[model samples]
Structure formats: C-alpha cells, structure tokens
Target: MEIYIVGGAVRDRLLNLPVKDRDWVVVGATPEQMLAEGYRPVGKDFPVFLHPDTHEEYALARTERKVGKGYHGFTFHTSPEVTLEEDLARRDLTVNAIAEASDGSLIDPYDGQADLKAGMLRHVGEAFVEDPVRILRLARFAARFDFAVAPETMTLMRRMVDEGEADALVAERVWQELAKGLMESKPSRMLLVLRECGALARILPEVDALFGVPQRADYHPEIDCGDHTLRVLDYAASQGQPLTVRFAALGHDLGKARTPRDILPRHIGHEIRGIEPLSELCRRLRVPSDCRDLAHITLVHHTKVHQAFELRPATVLKLFKECDALRRPDRFRLMLDACLADARGRLHFEEAPYPQKAYLESLLAAAAQVDAGAVAAACDDKSSIPAAIDAARTDAIVNAREYWQRDN
Candidate 1:
C-alpha cells in the first residue's frame, strides 16, 4: 500500500502556511489490512483510522456518490482498488484536491496547484455540486485565504442555491462553518460571498435582510445596514477578537432590518427591537450560551455603551448590574470590544476614539470594589440591605465618574 498526505496538510504546505494537522489517504489498502498494521478504526461513515504512533488521521482511498440531499446524502465506495487520484477528485476545491506522495512527488491531476498559484478557488469537478456544505466551505476559504472564487465555481454555487441544495444544509453544519468564518482574518468576505450566491438569505435571513435596509447617512455614510454589519465584523477581526466578540459584531445591528419605513433612516428603537431576531438566530443555530449571551448583551446594551458619557451614574451602575460585569469580567471586556467595533466600523470612523469603553470599564471596576457586605451591615433595617448595597455601588460609580471628568 502507498500512503500519501492529502487535503489541508498538502494545501497549507503549498501556501507556506503552518500545517496544524495531517490527513493521509492510504491507496490500495483495506480496513482489514489497516487493522493488522496497528491503525485504529474511528470513522463511522467510511474507512478512517488513526496512526498508532503519530495519532494523525488516515482515511482509506474512497469515492462518493450523491444519493439524496444535503451533506449526509452520500454513498461511499472504498476498496483496495481505489486510486489516490480518484479520492482527490471528490474534494470541494481544486486547491484542496492536490496530494503529495511519500517521496515528495506532487500529484495535481485537476490542476489544483495552478489554481493555488493564481490565488483562485475553483471547483474540482462537476461533482462539487453534490454536497451543499461545499458552498459554505468555499466561502470560508475565500475569507481565510483572501482568494477570488472562479466565475464557473460561483455560477455553480448560485445554481446550487437556485436548485435548493443550499437550503438542505443542516443547522449545526451551517453554524460550524459560520463560526469558523467569523474568526477568519476578513470574515466580511464570507458573508459577501454567501450573499452573492444567495445562500445568505437561506441560512441567515436576518443578516440578509440588512443588505438593502437604509441607515442614517450622517451617522453611517455607508447608508446600508448590511454593509455596516460586515464592516463591524471586519473591525472585530482586525482587533483579533475571539469568536464570541466577532459573532456579537455580526448580530449587533439585526434590528435595523425591522425598522418602519415611514421613519426613513432613523431606527429609534432598533436596539430593543433587535433582541427578538438575535434570539431567534441563536436558537435556530443552537449557538452556545457564551456566544448567545454576549451577542444578546451587545445588541441590547450597545446604545447604552455608545451613550455612556450621557448616562447618569445610577444608569451606568444599572448597566453594569444588568450585564453582570462583576462576575464575568472577560465577557464584559468582549462586550466592550463588540461595542467599540460597532462604533468605529462606519464610513470615515475607523479611527474614531471610543472613550466610552474605558469610562464604563473604570465605572465597573469602582462599583465592583464597593463592599456590599459592609453596606448591608450598616443598613438600619434588614429589608433595606439590598437597597443600601445598590446605593453604595451607585455612589462608587459616581465618584469614579467624577474622578474621570476631573482627570480629563
């Protein structure tokens, strides 16, 4: 049997990127042969094994045929006769279909290396339309590598959407790709690509609705809610923010889509109006609580964050309490990061200062330092203890704000 490195390992190596994991295609090998050679079987749907020494994945050479719909609707054929070229042909992108032999010889039957050198994302074959998940994967690769999608591949992706293949994708798989794309260096490209292919409306309708929705031109010179959201996502990525923060940035302005047209570009209550759609998005995707909570907080309280200097000390204290910033400082910081991204993601505002972040952070710190136990102990009546602690925290924030104003 001849083993060859394949897929991401080969793709990343050719691009001068770090190979985090390696996958192997064992040509001319059976499961029985792999087992006898000490490889541990792990794949439930196909023949995949783990190396006894390196523990890296080693999948047997196999080919797939589309049977029904979505990603799971596939039949796999694996045998000792399956060639490495056959296995490579099943990959989604031409750049990912190339393989390398044990002797360092390059195999490029589909001209994947040429496409990679041209920074192009082209499909491997007509079989690319069989799997709906490839649409998301291609969009993600566009974001990750900043590569241009080939016209033919994009036309095929659009055809997939028109033919309802894109709609057949499962929610979990959609979220998986979305989360990975959000953490890329320029996630807006992913969203734009999906929109171009009509998959955004199918998978993320709330976000898609923002594309043509108008925003106040004076505040958002971009004048498009969807465009603003993409800018916020890119800004979050530029800050090296984590997945939660980036997700929050993506969902932060969803409410603007529901704005009343008579109001024109003004969305007076969009902050509160956004909660329903954001919650729906999180629930539908089965998003994790941490990401859901941060997105919720950013959507609901971002206006407060932007108007931090205008709010009263008591209101600021309430903001801290509502966000539970004392108990979860890291999430609070992420919330601030999301708000900062939103504030500066508009046209001509990329470098705008967001003093509100530091102000609120200082206020939270001061409020957290207030000794609740001491205040409760000093209260005259037992029923007044909670009120006394609240007053003390507010007073601490007041003092912190005064100090900030004085220093400035």
Candidate 2:
C-alpha cells in the first residue's frame, strides 16, 4: 500500500504555517488489509482508519458520486485501484489538494503549488458543487489565508448557491463553519465572500439584510450596517477575543437591518428590536448557550453600555443586576469586550477609546464590594432583603462614580 500526507497539513506546511494535524490517504489498500496492519476503522460512510500509535486518521483512496443534495448526499467508492490523484480531485480547494508521498516527494496534479504561491483559492474540479459545505470552507480559508478567490471558482460558488445547494446545508455544519470563521484573523472576509456568492442571504438572511441598510454616518462613519457588523467582528478577532465575544460582535447590530425606512439612517430602538431575529438565528443554528447568551446581552445592552456615562447610578446598578455581572463576571467582561469592538468598528474610528467599558467595570467592581450578605443580614424584614441589597449597591455605585469622575 502507498501512503501520503494530504489536505491541511500539506497546505499549511507549504505556507510556512505551523501544521496542527496531519491526515493520511492510503492508496492501494482495502479495509481488510488496513485492519490486518493494525489500523482501527473509524469511518461510517467510508474507509477511514486510525493509526494505532499516533491515532491520526488514515482514509483510503476513494471517489464520491453525488446522488441527491447537500453534503450528505454523496456516496463513496473506495477500492485498492483508486489512485491518489482521484482522491485529491474530490477535495474542495486546489491548494488543499496537494499531497506529499511517504518518500517526501510532492504531487501537484492540479497545479496547487502555483495557486498556493499566488495566494489564490480555486476549485479542484467540477465535483466542487457536489458538496455545499465547500462554499463555507472556501470562505473560511479566505479568512485564514487572506487569499483571493479565483473568479471562475466564485462564479461556480454563486451557481451552487443559485441552485439551492446552500439552503440544503444542515444547521450544525453551518454553525460549525461560521464559528470557525469568526475565530479567524480576518473574519470579515468570510462574511464578504459568503455575501459575494449569495450564500450569506440563504444561510443568514438577517445578516444579509444589513448590507444595504443605512446607518447614521455621524456615529457609524461607515454608513452601512453590514459594513459596521463586519468591522465589529474583525475588531473582536484582532483583539484576540474568545469565540463568544466575537459571536456577540457579529450579532450586536442585527436589529439595524429591521429599521423602519421612515426613520432613514436612524436605528432607534434597534437594540430591543434585535431580540427576535437574533433569537431566531441562535435557535435555527442550535448555537451553544454561551455564544447565544453573550450575543443576546451584547445586542440588547450594547447601546446602554455605550451610554454608561449618561445613565444614573441606580440605572447602572439595575443594568448590572439584569446582566448578572457579579455572578458571571467572565461573561460580563466578554459582553463589554463585544461592546468595545462595536465602538471601535467604524470608519476612522478603529482606535477610538471606549471609556464606557472601563467605567462600567469600575461601577461593577464598586457595587460588588457592597457585601450583599451583610446587607441581607442587616435588613429588618425578609421581604426587604432584596431592596436592602439594591440600596447598598446603588449607594456604593454613587460613591464610586463620583470618585471615578474626580479621577478622570
């Protein structure tokens, strides 16, 4: 049997990137032969085995036939006669189709090396349309490598989207790709690529609707809601924020898309109006609770957080209670980070200071020092304990705000 290292390991290595995982493709090998050689079979839809020692995956050389629709529609054919070239041909991108033989010989049947050097993303073959997930994967690769998509490949992606392949993608896979893309260095590229191919409208219409929507240029400077969202997402990524924070940045301004035309560029009450669409997005994708919660809090309270200095001490204390900042400070900090990303994500405002985040943090810290347990103990009646705690926190916030103002 002939074995070769394939896919991302080869691609990343060629780019001088740190290879995280290595995938293997074994040509001229049957499942029975693989088992006899001590490789454990792990694939359900095809012949994939794991090495007994390294535990890395080794999939047999195979070809796929598109039977129905979406990613799961493909049927696999694996045989000892299957060539390494045939297996490589079934891959999504040309850059990813390169293979390295056991003896360190490189194989580039589709001219993947040329495209890799040119920093281009191009399809390997016509089989690219057989799987809809390729569209998401290509967009994600654009975000990762900052590579330009070949025009013909983009045309092919648009055709696939037009043929309803994008709609056939499953919820889990959509969320998976989107989450991965959000964590990439230039997540804005992923969104813009999906938009260019019209897959963004199919998969995330709420986000797509924001593209042409107008926003007040005095505040946004970008003048487009979609542009603002992209900036926010990229800012979150550039700050090395976690997935939850990045997700929140992406969803924070979704309500702006639903603004009434009579209001023109103003998105007043968009934060509250954003709840329905954002909730639907999270529910449809079956998004993880932490991501969903952080996004929700950022969407609903971001404007309030930005207006922190204008809010009364009691109002600030109430906001803290609603956000549960004292109990779940990490998530609260993530929400603030998302708000900070939004603040910095406008035209010529990339480095703008977000004093509100620090102000809120200071207020939260001061209120948290109020000793709720002691306040509850001192309350004369059980019914008044909640009020007593709130009063103490409000007073603490008042003092802290005055101190902060004086210091600033």
Candidate 3:
C-alpha cells in the first residue's frame, strides 16, 4: 500500500544533482484498484496513472516484452505481485535503475549505487538489447554523467548496431535522444561513443566521412577533419554554451568533408553547399524548427562574419538583417570559437594567413547586438537612412535613453 518515489528523481537526488522530474511506484496496487482510488489512467500499454492530489506520475510495477520491431514494439505486463526490483531491472543504465523507498531508504537491486559511486554506466540486464533505443540512451547517459560506458555494455551496444537492431529506431526517437545528448554538460564523449559503436555512420554518413579526410597540408597538418571536429566539440564543452549552439559548433565545418581536394588548399563556397545538406539533415533528424534556424545561421554567417573586416557597411548590415531574427548569438560565438579551435589545432595554421585579433574583436563587437527591426525600419525609409551606415549619434542617443528609462 506504500507509494515510493523512484527513477531519475531519486537517482539525481542521491547524486546531489537537480531532481527536476518526479515519478512514483505504487506497490500492492492494480490498474483497477488505482482507478478506484481516483488515479487517472494514462498508459494504454501499461498500468501508469496520475495521482489525484499530486498530479505526479504513478505507475504500478510492470514488466515489458518486445512485441515486434522498433522502439514502440513492446508489450507491458502489470500486476499487484510485481516487485519494484523487477521494474528497475528493465531500465537502460544501472545508475538510473536505483529507486528511493518511501522511508527514504536507497534501493539498489542491481548495484546501481555502486556504479554511480564508481562513475560508471552499466546496462541493467541482458534484456537491454530488447530495444535498440537503449544504445542512444546509454550514449546520452555518458554525456550527462561524463561517465564511461562499461566495456561489456558497449559490446552489447555494438552488437545491437551490427545486428540491424538499430535500424528499427525511428528518426524521431534517434533525434530526440541525440538532441538530449547534445544538450548535456559535454557532448564530445557522446559523439566519440556514437562513432565507436558505428551509430554515427547510420545517423550521419557525411560526418562519418570526415573521419579520415585529409585537409591540404598548407592549411591543416595535425589530423583529419574528424579529429579536428572532436577538438571543436571539446572547445564547445569548455565554453559551456547551450545545446542549439553546440549543434551548430559540431556541424559548422561538416561541408568541408564533402568538398573535392582537387581544389587543393581551398574549398571555395563550401559554406553555401553545406547549408542545404545541413538543413535537410536537420529536417530528417526531426530537429525543432527553432534549432534548425540557429544551425542555418551558423552555416551562413560563419564565412560572412569572417570576412567582416573587408565588408562594406551595406553588406554587413545585410548579413545582420539576414540573421538577426534567428536569436542565436550563442551559436555565432561558439562558431567563432570552433573555427579558432580548428585553426589552432592545424599545423599549417601556425604560419597561415589569419585575421588579427584586434580586427576580429572589432567585427565581433559590431555584430554583438543588432536591432533587427530598427534596421528593417531604417531600410524602409525613403527619406535617407543611409544603408548600413554607423548608427547616427542622434539615433544612438534616443535608443540608449529608451533602454535606460525602460530598465529604470
């Protein structure tokens, strides 16, 4: 008759991490009994309900079986006889399997607390392979915890990928898991894990192709495109930017891999070419429209912003006009950092032509805060708002005054 908080909320609480979500396991309860208790039924395939007073999720102990293919293909069984231990055992990673009993006692049926203490991520049971979604889940767990996956668990994941089990994963589930991983404290490890398990090839062949592609010795002498990408990912993590920006940082140079080396030492217009593919890639992966727009801005403005030193006021304004609505300042900043990181990692960059820090800083400052609507309003004026000219002293004064008063 006791209801105990369980799953991620409990695990996160034990780790001293923020417990953002809460769920409970109701022992000695049946679906009919829960309904009679005023809990609203929610899970069509399992005995999950919402508590009447708390509105928190409450599920009767349940077990599931693979009914068919893909992540949705599961048959769940629930009964009053099922124990909490049985439910925890079916979870993907051990660190997430521990539950908190109603008395605030730690429940470690799978030794998940030990794994958590040891900074490891282990599969709950052999039943892990019952769903291919677990592979991405395991990778995401590593990103979130900065923990390494156990070797045997990785072996199981690789087998899942090689056995065609991963093919059953739908685009939506794959992207959802990947976006979550991308938002983690660090995503480089996630990519590394994905690549090691052959999941990257299935998810993004273009990025996988970057693995061994050689850049001209004059520009890149350290490693192939892929290794440099990993360094960029590391930089993105170090900078601690948000997920959308991080995705842009990871994808910024992806088109370089698709360019022909016959052009040698140069991949002209690669930025333009990269955009279409990147857009399609995001769409196919089910990236949210808002995030996809940020990715687009990174691809378009990356090269344009680099050339800002040579740009006329009109051109610069046009660039901002094109991107101002995207609300991706963080993405743009990460793109600059990634580009700089890539350059520093390449041997040829030591002596190659590079923008002076002063000039780059000035350009970045100009781009820092753009008034998209004001610029558009100015553009529409027939009277003589000079295109992309410096903000007039009068306009600057009025804007600053408005901002100050608004804040006050």
Q: Write the per-residue lDDT of candidate 1 for residues 1-408, one digit (tens) a residue.
A: 999998889999999999998889999999999999999999999999999999999999999999999989999999999998999999999898889998999999999899989999999999999999999999999999999999999999999999999889998999999999999999999999999999999999999999999988999999999999999999999999999999999999999999999996999999898999999999999998989999999999999999999999889878888899988877998999999999999999999989999998899999889998888888889999988888889999999999999997
Candidate 2 error regions (>4 Å): none
Against the hidden true structure, what lDDT does model 1 obtain? 0.94
* lDDT for residue 301 in candidate 3, whole number 0-100: 69
Task: Tell me the lDDT of model 2 at 172.
Answer: 97
The C-alpha lDDT values of all candidates are 0.94, 0.94, 0.72
Which of the two candidates, 2 or 3, achieves a greater lDDT against the reference? 2
Give the RMSD in angstroms, all C-alphas superposed, for model 1: 0.9
All candidates' TM-scores?
A: 0.98, 0.99, 0.80
Q: By lDDT, is 1 or 3 better?
A: 1
| Collision pairs in model 2 | none
